[model samples]
Structures are given as structure tokens and as C-alpha cells.
Target chain A: MSKKVLVLGETREGALRNVSFEAIAAAKKISGGGEVVAVLLGESVSDFGNELVAYGADRVITVEHPHLKSYTSDGYGQAFMAVVDQEQPEAIVFGHTAVGKDLSPKIASKLQTGLISDVTDIEGEGDDAVFIRPIYSGKAFEKVKLKEDGVVFVTVRPNNIAPLEREERSGDVSSLSVDITNLRTIIKNVVRKSAEGVDLSEAKVIIAGGRGVKSKEGFEPLQELADLLGGAVGASRGACDADYCDYSLQIGQTGKVVTPDLYIAAGISGAIQHMAGMSNSKVIVAINKDPEANIFKVADYGIVGDLFDVIPLLTEEFKKVM
Target chain B: MNIYVLVKRTFDTEEKLVVSGGQIQEDGAEFIINPYDEYAIEEAITVRDAHGGEVTVVTIGDEEAEKQLRTALAMGADKAVLINTEDDVEEMDQFTAAYILAEYLKDKEADLILAGNVAIDGGSGQVGPRVADLLDINYVTTITSLEIEGETVKIVRDIEGDAEELETSLPLLVTAQQGLNEPRYPSLPGIMKAKKKPLEELELDDLDIDEEDVEAKTETIEVYLPPKKEAGRILEGEIPSQVSELVSLLRSEAKVI
Candidate 1:
């Protein structure tokens, strides 16, 4: 029943993202008391290997290469394949992040294995695992499992799984030298936008707006509330189309899908399109004037008052307690 | 810049999916080009227009998928191909879909390939990268911006809400995220012309793909809806009291804060 699970410890800005630790958590569950190895692939990432140990990785494999400073499917693919060839893990886990989504399928395909992506939950361990992933953009869910014997490859969505509690245990750290060759895609430069605060997808709390937010200035109150709560601000398609916010903040079927712990929909009418993205949130609070608004249907709590009045009061109240 | 845009007809995101006996009942569901794929269709047209090339929209589905492929043609794709698998293939995972697509495209010498970041209905996002892997090429997913000059390319990829810019080259596959380009609706004239465009049809035999060889590696064991939530507890009173009550509910009842 036990197995060796390999988790790719993904990083951004020289440190592992929260999802990396979450992946380790998932690996522990899927490993079924077997070895859980975390592979940190980057230019110089030995410092973060111990952090993985505290987070429950039984061992850490650091695959360093100069070409890996920037991520290309080809560069990372070759490097990761080398680690896989060496480790030959029974299962592989990755965070359903941008880098994970891009690299996972490529590797799974090369291994001729089935990949259950964006898995929100897992029911079993090893080959017997049943992976639950949202389909129809969160309108429905499906339970899928591998049909034949192969590597159990999966990608876990962010904020869905809790990372393990850190322990003082030290894990064995090893180094791997990969033969990097025939680089196809090259990174001329990486222009990072949206560095203002926490990432919207990984943020524990979110303040989302809609058309009722009215003007660009309307988002100011929401942003202030987000800052106060230590959350990120999101927008409905209506708000983005109205030019009140950027499309990057759009949350809908055509936009980013998020599953934060606390989601606050302010001045927003719950269009089905918008709900497709955020309906999976743990707790939703809809602050809108329309009592009949569809958002109230899904919200755990509702305040049927003008958001302009309610939002500032909510921010003030939270400031008192938080 | 010979381009291939992989398209799929998906259930409209707004429709409530009705699953019966482990299958989605599609009787009354509205079907459209997966909205994300529209960006790929639009970007392909833009790239083809800028550089002298042809854009071919390809899809694998039943005859019902022709409607979506025609829409792609009306949006300026040079041609359309529907690999009807209603007769041969059933119960597919990503591997099967990617294998068939790669088989058909093996000899095409395609310069650029485009797909949506994820299909709304399946939401797996594996086919694009899998096909690229089978074809032994490079790929970037969830791209917001793409600039191609000669053989070199520049892309701004969406990493969650943030962006990462990278440069790649030809024979590359890129999946479209939103904000790549506003997908244009089919003009009436364009729609009329699409009626006359070349729409080719193929089957498993044509691509030399055996159903067993490209069989799915995963199986769907269950299809069900999330449990319906109880009607929300609405707090009524003055703004100040309502805010306070909500905060207390979050703390005492939900405990999310």
C-alpha cells in the first residue's frame, strides 16, 4: 500500500510558493506512509530543501542547472525527466499552478501515464486513488482514476489542501546533475505584473467587485478593504468590461478560477459566468442591494444593503476585531 | 506560419449540467465554441493575417461539432476539419485525444499550434501539452499576449494572476488565456462565406489510429453535482447592526475569519 511519491517543489522569486508545501502535504496523503520526496529544480535552491523537510518531505532532490534560471517547457522538461529517470517514483504530484499545469502534462505524456489535473481532493492512495476534479468550470465535479498500472500523476489546485504542520525533523537532501540539451523555448526576459500584494488565487481571503462597483474609484474602497483584511481584490466580468478594473482581476468561466477560504462579493450581481469561477469558495459573503440577487443564493451570509454604505462599515468592523 | 487551432464544442458554462446514469444529458444544453478557444481562433487568424499562411481549425467530436468548426471558419480560419469519433471512440481521457490529434498532425509540418488553456466542460487542460509532447515540440500555457516575428516569438503568460514573459520559437504550441485578444463575433458576410468554406471530415481509419492503441488511461467513475447549499441566512437591520451580525456569524458560525 505504501509508495514513493515525487513532488515538484515549485518556486517563484527564489522561494517555494505556498503550493509547494501543499503539494508535499498531498504527497504524504498519497504516499500512504511511504517515502515522499520533493525535487527542487532551479539554479541554486539548496536553502529551501530543509523547509520541505519540515513540511513533511522524507527527502529532497535539488536538480540545479544554469538554463533553469528561467522556465521553459523544454528546459525544465529535460531536467525533470532526468530526475524521474533517476528516482522513478511510483507517483508524481504537482501543484495545479501555471508552471505545474504547463510542465505536468508534458511529463505525463512522455511517461505515457494518465494525468488527473486540478484535483481538489483525493480519496485513496497509490494506484487505487480516486481523484476529484472540478469540471464544467466548477458547475459539476467528476471522479476519475487510472485505468491501468502506471505512475499516478496528478496536479492539486491551490488553497484546496492544507500544508502539513512543520516539524523539526531533517530530511536527507541530495543533488542531481541533469544533462540539459536542445533547448527549444528560450526566455529572453520575464516581465512580472501584479506584484502589488498577495496572489489572487492563493490569497486566503478575497474581495471581489462587479458592475455595481460603478467607477474606477469604486474599487478604491474594495482595495482598502482587501488591504485591511490581508486579502486580494477580484472583479466580475462586468466590472472588467466596464473598465472599472483590469481583466487580470476578472473571475469567471473566461477568467481565473479561485477557491479561497473567504470570498466577499461586493456590489456584484452573481452572473452564472462569474459564479463559475468562485462558487467553490469555502465561505462567500454577498454584499449587494438586490435581495433577489443570485449571488445571495450561494452566499453563506448576505447583507442586502448598498455596498457603498455596507463595505466601509464592514471594513471598520473588521479593523476593530482583526 | 502554417497554423492549427484545436477546438472543442463544450457545454455553455452557464448551463446547469444534468447528469443521468453517469453521463451528461446534452438534450437541452447549449453548445458553443469553448470561449477560451475563441481566443486561440482569434490569435491564429491574427498571426495568419500578419504572416502569409493558412489557419486550419481542427476538432474531434460528433457532427454537432461542425457548428463550432464553421464558427471558427467564419472568424477567418482558412479551413476546418472534423474528426468524427462518435462511431469509433468512446470514454476518452486526455491520452486518447492527444494521440489522435498528434497522429493527424504528424506530417503536417505545422509552424504554430494553439489551444485553449483548459476546456470548460472537462477542465483537464492536458490535451494541448500532451499533443505537443507527442509531436516533440515546445509549449506555453495560459498566454495573455503573443508576438511572433519570423521564427522567434515573445509571450506574456498568465501565472495565476501574475504574468511571466518568455521567448520561444517556431513549431511551438501556445494555449490562450483570456485577455490575449478579444474574440470577434462572426460577421453576417463572414458567416455566409463560411458556408462555402472547405470543411473536411475524417475518421479513426483515416488517421491510422486504433481505438485500443489510443485508449484512455483514466476512467470516469462518477459524475455528480455538488450538494446544493442551504439558503443563506439573510441579516436584516440597520447597516451598522447588519455588519456586526455578519461578522459575529463569520466568527461564531462559519469561523472563516
Candidate 2:
């Protein structure tokens, strides 16, 4: 039951994102002894093709166009459709990043195929691939299998799958030129809010604050701890609504859903909306004054004290250990 | 200008979902318009007001969903359409829903189409872009701001940790995101006016789509709640002592740090 699987490698700021390699590993799993081909679409991304091969791809197809230097739904969709038409892969895999979420559906609709998005795990069921994904804001899980037979599309969530180690597999690199035209929507520019930090969705550790953090200046202490741990800083909707932090840092049903290895909640009351986003974290630590805060119910460790007094002490203690 | 907004009836995110007999228990559940779609409805009304046009809200659900459509009408949508598939389609996935919507909209000649970035219940964020694809139109998702003039549109879309500005033209679709606008509540006067708003109900046959043509491409094998989190150990005593104890526990028990 071998099948040809195509993995779409994503790039940000001229470097391949880690999820691209993770997707290659996923492609290898579902390929079932068939070929796993990686597709890279961007400006001057051909140099990164060999890296994808080392991760797991059997071959790489690089498509470079000046119009693809940045991502637009139309431009990427056209390029992907061209690749699909040429390769005729039985299945296509993409990392469920912003680009993937924005582009995959357009391609799926053009091909008139079903797309299983944000898949965390995959299994073989009688020659068919079954995708496991979270629904209802991670409150429940659903196993979905495509009923149609032609070509299947899927987007894998980042950090869920482990990427393959570097191996000297000399995969052939091929060049492709696609005619991308008639784009109605054009990206003028990408305005970055912050220059560099741990990507919240992909971070291994996250220290999140709520309204109890007080003011925009109040997050300085939380940021210090997060930087010390090499983790990301996140906020509840209450914090975002209160303008204590940008909405980009918000984690809840209406914002980003994250599953980090370690999640520390400080000065936050655990509202269900907020818990729906991060309750899936491996180890949760709640630091709040209220012993009866709902966050303590989901936390693996709780500290019933004022965060202002507790966070600095915790940071100092961690400094001693690390 | 003819505007249409896609609305969905979903369970309130606050309610804890109960699973029984391999299906979610629906009785006694509080249903409301998917919170995100409220932005779409509100945006549509704003757009219609700026330009001389009418706003129509559409949903695919059973009779119970009419209440949500009425709510949308009360929120300022000029009309509402309920494509009830209660008996026709037993199980509907994103593909089926988008297919039916595209089929019905093929002849509507809508100048602008808006939907929520994703529904809270499913959270796939697929239907808006899928419908636009099926109709061979332009689409953008996670839009925080939108401006329309004549046939051109400008939008600011939300990305990972920032925003991107884009320019597009009419006959386009965009999914509403947070910060787009504050959705208004239904006023007493508006609720009374909603009673007379045009509300139409259709079925699969009305769209000339057979149940088999738009059959769900994916099947759900199971549905169950996530594992319940166990009670945690609460550190007691002085602040300094609690800090030391937490550090020890992190090293010995959790092993995260």
C-alpha cells in the first residue's frame, strides 16, 4: 500500500521553519514505503532543498519566483496547484502554520479534494489514512478518514511530530517554473510587532499572565522569567482585553491554542475559555493568591501566594539551579 | 452592493460538552451565534450602511437555528436564509457545508461575502476560503480591519505575531477576526423590526444539490472529551519556603526545568 506523498516545506525570512522538517517526517510515516517528495516555494529557496532530503524527503522540487518572495493566498495557491498537477501525489502534507492555514483550503477546493487540517497524529486503517485532530478548542478529539479516493490533503500541527535526524541521503533536486498571474489580493508588507522571540505556538515552555499582571508595564517581570527559561510569554483574553498585552499574546478559544511542555500561570484566574487553550499542556504550574482559583484545578503544581512575591523568588531559585 | 454573511449556530464555549453514546449531548445546551460570526454580521451591516445595499445572513442548520438567524436580523442584517438539512443530511462536515453554500450562492451575484475565521465548535477555518475557491473568487482570512470603496478593498490581516496589509478587489470573500469591530447587541426596537425581516428556508432540493453529490468527504470515527487534569499539589508556608519547595519538586517530580 505504498503511496507518493508530497510535503510542502515552509520558509520564513529566507530560512526553512522547523515545521517543514517535521512535516517531512510525517510524510515519511504515511508514505508506506513509497516516495516522499518535498516541495519548496519561495524566492531563492533552492539552497534549502538538500536539508529537506536529509530530514526524510526522497527528492525535492524547488519553485522560485519573485512574486513568491512573500506569501499571498492566491500566489501560493497557484504555485501549489501547479506542483500538484505535475507530481500527481496521492497525498499532500503541509505544516499547519499561518501560511498553511491560509493556502491549503484554496488548493484543496481547486482540486476538489478533502483536507484534514491541524492533524496531531495519523494512523493507517486498512490502507486508508486516519487523521486525529482536536475539535471544540481541544476539548475533544476526532478521528477523520477521507471517503473520496483521488488525492488527500492534510496539515500537521507543529511540535506534535518529531523531525528525522540529519542523514546523508542525496535526494535529487529539481527546478520548476510556474506561471502565477491574475492575483486579486496582494500583500503590501508584513509589519512585525516584535523582532525576535520564541514562537508561542512552537515553544517548549510558556509563562502566561492574566489580568492580575496589572498594567502593560506589569508584564516586565513575566517577560524576564520567560526569557530566563528560553520560553514564550502568553496572556489570557482578560489580559488582552485589558490592554495589558497585545492580542498576539492572547491564548484562549478566540486566540492561539498552544500545547507546550511546561505552562506557568501567574496572577491568572482560570476561566474555562482560557483553559480551553492551554489545559493540554504537559505540566501546568499555577501561581495565584486564590487557592480556589479554577486554574489550580488543572495545574499539576499550585502556589497559593501573591505572584508579585512568588515570581521573583521562583526566578531567583531557577537562576541558582540553571 | 449585495452583501452576504455566513453565520453558524454553535454551543456556547463556556458550556462543558457532555458525551453520551458516542455523541455530544445537545439537550439543555445553550446555543448562540458563533461568537466570531457576530463580527461578520456586524461588519456586513456596517458595509451595507456605508454603501447603498442590503445585508443577508445565511446559516445551514435545522429549525432551531432560525433563532440565531433572527438574532442576526435583529443585529441589523436585512434578511436571513436558513438552509435546513435536518433530515436530508444526517452528518455534515466542513466540505459538505461549504459545497452547499457555494451551490446556493452561485446565482446570488453577491458583491461581498464574509464569514468568521473559524467556528468555535469545529475550528477548522475552511468554509470561507473553500466557498471562495468554488466560486472562483478572491478570499482573505483573519482580517482585523476592512475598508471598501467602489470595487476595491483594503484589509489588515492577522498573522502569527504581527499583521499584514493587503489590497484586493470586489467579488471577494474575507473572514472576520477579533478586533474587526464590536458586535452590537439586539435593541428592543431592532428585535421588533426583525419579525418583519425577510427570512427564507430552503432544503437540499432547493439548491438543486442531491444529498449524494455533497456527501461528507470525511467521516468522524469517534468523539470524546480530553483526559481530565488531576488535582495539583499546592505549596503551603512562607514565600521563600514555597519557592524552594517548588524548585525541588520541579527537579524531582515534574523534571520540566
Candidate 3:
């Protein structure tokens, strides 16, 4: 008998995020003998439901409603509750992206279960399920034995698991209805960045700035360079706090984590707090006036210079080539 | 509105965490109330003070968490409940913790329960809503500001890019964000008074919590230091020369260009 695993396949702008596929891969690893079913909830999801099979879902449970055309916490949770009540799988997994972050807890609560959230590692083979989550903000990890239940809930951290290959298989897509009348909260609007480039979390190359960038105007050239290279712009806590950039751009212990192929630091002093976040990146480049800046400790290449002058030159050169 | 603030004690931020043998070495670590929980406690007290209702600080941890509970009591919470779990229990992993807490709150007659959106430690941000779910009440996380009118609770959450306003009924759960309020420091007088404040301690058995069902879903295979980053070679020469060399390196060697 196969263990039954349920996955909440998350999406944005009608397309499934890579993290959803990654979640499916993780579900495949831990499901044991269970069949993996992907739950895709949205408005008009018929066209998108077919993609789940290739991504390793043995079954696709799709909940389509006009209110769920876009992502809302209430719609997703109710749909999930309905699905869980119907399937009663051995394990339910979600991608710990923004959508899952909001949706998982609600569903878990409704089920009167514990949600192992933001787990970097998960393994369930024995009668008990085991999870590993960073404690004290990545300072430590706690190996947790989940509460005994017929079904377990987990939210996997994004980008931690690589997506498995697409097999030549298609699953059954079943439509389900959810009663969302009790949901009072509504999404008035969703604002997206107008910039056309790789997402910060998914970027292969990341050029970051910090307080050393000096001013907001200094970021224009860095943005230009990032745009030229189809990369993303990131910032250290100092830069976000200094008002040189927005908090959304912050990449550090208290901010976003970037593990791109190339991480270029412009004027970042590399505080330990900041390093805790992005130190996992494959390669690092540090450009700063103070040669002893801690960023060089992590950098694969160091260029001691002023960002104001260097960024413009670099941007122009990259632009000419592109 | 009558509010309940959930506080947690965590390893102080200053402590150098050394991961050894798949565990955190706490030989010289100091503990403090989680910074975010402070914000939650302070915000709850402020709301209670303004709205003319009681504020209670609740924690699900060992005796060490009582320090934070006492601190919350001194900061103006009317009462404190320390739900002491086993010493080895990991934070937020025990569904029994949330379940026991919800059961305790069920009798408190609270109009709202306030907690830090997420503990800085595990950063799971799930317990409050899970408790709310167990309690079968409405829930909202990441609330930056909370307003109560009549029987409705209005909350503003810092969502992606902007603040979103959510309205729930009384007896709702709210998880507060950092910007919610500035937590007050325990002054000399407050600290002195804190020692006199009543702290009720309840064991898991006292709360009638049966932990036979839930278990940890995942386990840590290993805990190791992140790979050490090798220092970079300092590029020599003038601004234009350095730029050219940087470009050359990025193109030929790093290949990120």
C-alpha cells in the first residue's frame, strides 16, 4: 500500500512557481508507497491542472472559482480543507513561498494539526515523521518529532529542494468546489514590480548594495547593470535602514536570502547578520573602498574602489554588450 | 478589547551560536524575551490600557520563560500564565503547546489574542493561527496595527508591498509584526514590582493536554557550519584600470557577465 501525499501546488499570475515542483519532488521522496496528489486551486485552473502530472503528481485536485482566480488566503485554505477532508492523505506538503506561508497555517489550524513550517529538511519513513527547522533564526536547528497523526503537514522552504525531472506521465485532474462564503478578508489589489528581470529569489546573478552605496541615486546604475544582465538587485540591512533602498530589497539575516550563481556586493560591509543570509551563494564579488570590509572575507573576487564611479562604468559596458 | 499576548524566551542575539554534534552548544549563551514578542506584549498592553480591558501574557515553555512573563506583567499585563512543558521540548514543534494554550485561553474570556507574527528563533509564524484554528476562531498574521470597535477587530497586515486591512470578529487571533509597538524596558521600579506580581504555573497534566496524537513531522539529520567563504584577492590599480580588470575577470573567469 502506498502512502498518500497531498501537495498544494502554488502559483502566481496563472503559472506554477518552481517551488511547487520542488515541493512535489520532496513529497515524492517522503511519500514512501503513497500516491502523490497535487492540489491546484485557482480560478479557471483547467488549463494549468494538466502540468502537474509531468511534474510528478499522480493526481491533480483542482478547485476553480471566480473568487480564486488570483491568490487569496481564505479561498486557498477552504479549498485545502475541503481537499484534505476528502483525501485524508498521510502527509500534506506545501512550498514555503509567500502564498504557502499565508495559506498553510490556516489549513493546519482547521485540521487541528501542527504545521512544520519553513522546514529546511524533512524525512518521514518510520511510524513517526521527523522534521528539521532552523531555530533562533538559523543559529541552530532542532530535529523535531511531529505529533502522531494519520496525516502530517509540512511547508518546505523555497529553493532548498531542486525540482525533479518531468516524466512522461499525466495525472487525473479532478474539479472540486469550496465554500468560501465564510471568508471575510478580500485581496483588494496586488502590486508587482514593473522591472522585467529574473526574480530576486530565482536570479542566477545578484548585484547587491548597502549603506556604502551612499544614496538612492547610487542604485540607478546598479539597477541598470542588473537589468542589463537579467539579474536581480539586493540590499544589505544597512542600505534598507539608511533609506538608500526599500526594505523589500534587503538581503540578510533579517531579509531575503539569495543563493545565486554569482553574488556581487557593491559597497556592502558584510555584517555577520547579512552574511548569515546570503553566505550560501556559490560565488561572491566584493567592491568596496575599505579593502578590509568583511565582505571580502566571503568574496571570490575583490575590487577595492568607489561604487559611484565603478557602477556607472560597469553598467555602461554591460549595456553596450547587451 | 481584552487581549492576550503570547511571549517566548529565546537565546539572546549576542550569543555566538556554535553548532556542534548536530546541536546548538549553549555553554555560554544568555536568554532574553524574543524581541518580536516584546513588540507583541507591548502592543497588547497598549491596546488594553487604551480600551480599558485586561492584558494577560501567556507562554508555553519551561520556567525560564517566566522571566519574560514577569517582565510582561511588569510592563502592564494584568496577569501571566506560564504553561510549563518538558525541558527538552523544542519551541513551536509541540502541537500540544498550542493546544494547551488555546484551551487555557478558552476560559480567559479574551476578546483577542495577540502574539508576535513569528518568533525570531524558529521563525515559524504558525502557532498563533494554529491555536486559533484549534480554538475555532478567526485568525490573522503579520498584523502591524490593530483597532477594536464594538465587536469587530480591525487589523492591518504588512503584506507584499503594502498594508492590507482585515476585519474579523471579536475573539480573534492576531499575530503582531515588529513595527506594531516599541516594547518597554523593565525599569527599576517595574522590575521591583515584577517580583511581586502573581505568576500561575501549570503543568501539561494540569492543563489536561493529551499529547498522544501529534508528533514532530521532520528530524534534523545533521547540523554543521555553513561552508567557509574563501577571502578574495584584492585587485590593484586606478579606478578605470580596476574596472577593466573587474570586467575581464567577470567575463573570462567568473563568466557571470
Candidates sorted on DockQ, descending? 1, 2, 3
The residue-by-residue lDDT of candidate 3 on A34-151, one tens digit each, is: 6899998877776767777898889899888887865556667777888888988877889876677777877776666667787666666534446776666565566665545545
* Tens digit per residue, CA lDDT, model 3, B92-169: 353555666777888777787888767666678777877777777777777667877887667777553245665667
How many backbone overlaps does candidate 3 show?
Answer: 22
Error of 3 at A55 (Å): 2.8
Q: Write the per-residue lDDT of candidate 2 for residues B140-192, one digit (tens) a residue.
A: 99999999977789999988768999899999999998889999999999999
TM-score for predicted model 2 compared with the true structure: 0.97
Top lDDT model:
1
lDDT per residue as tens, model 1, A1-322: 7889999998776667899899998888888888999998888888899999999999999989898887778888988899899988989999988889999999999999999999999887755678898988888899998898889899999999899998999889999988888887766655555537588888889999999999999998899989988899999999999999888899988888999989999989999989999999999999998899999999999999999999999889998988
Off by over 4 Å in 3: A32-34, A69-73, A109-114, A121-133, A140-149, A166-169, A189-199, A320-322, B86-92, B160-162, B187-189, B210-222, B238-257
In candidate 3, position A49 carries an lDDT of 71
Using TM-score as the measure, name the better of candidate 1 and candidate 3: 1
- Report how closely model 2 matches the true complex, as a DockQ value: 0.79
Sorted by lDDT, highest first, which candidate order results? 1, 2, 3
What range of 10 consecutive residues in model 3 chain B has the weakest lDDT sum? B212-221
User: What DockQ does candidate 1 have relative to the true complex?
Assistant: 0.81
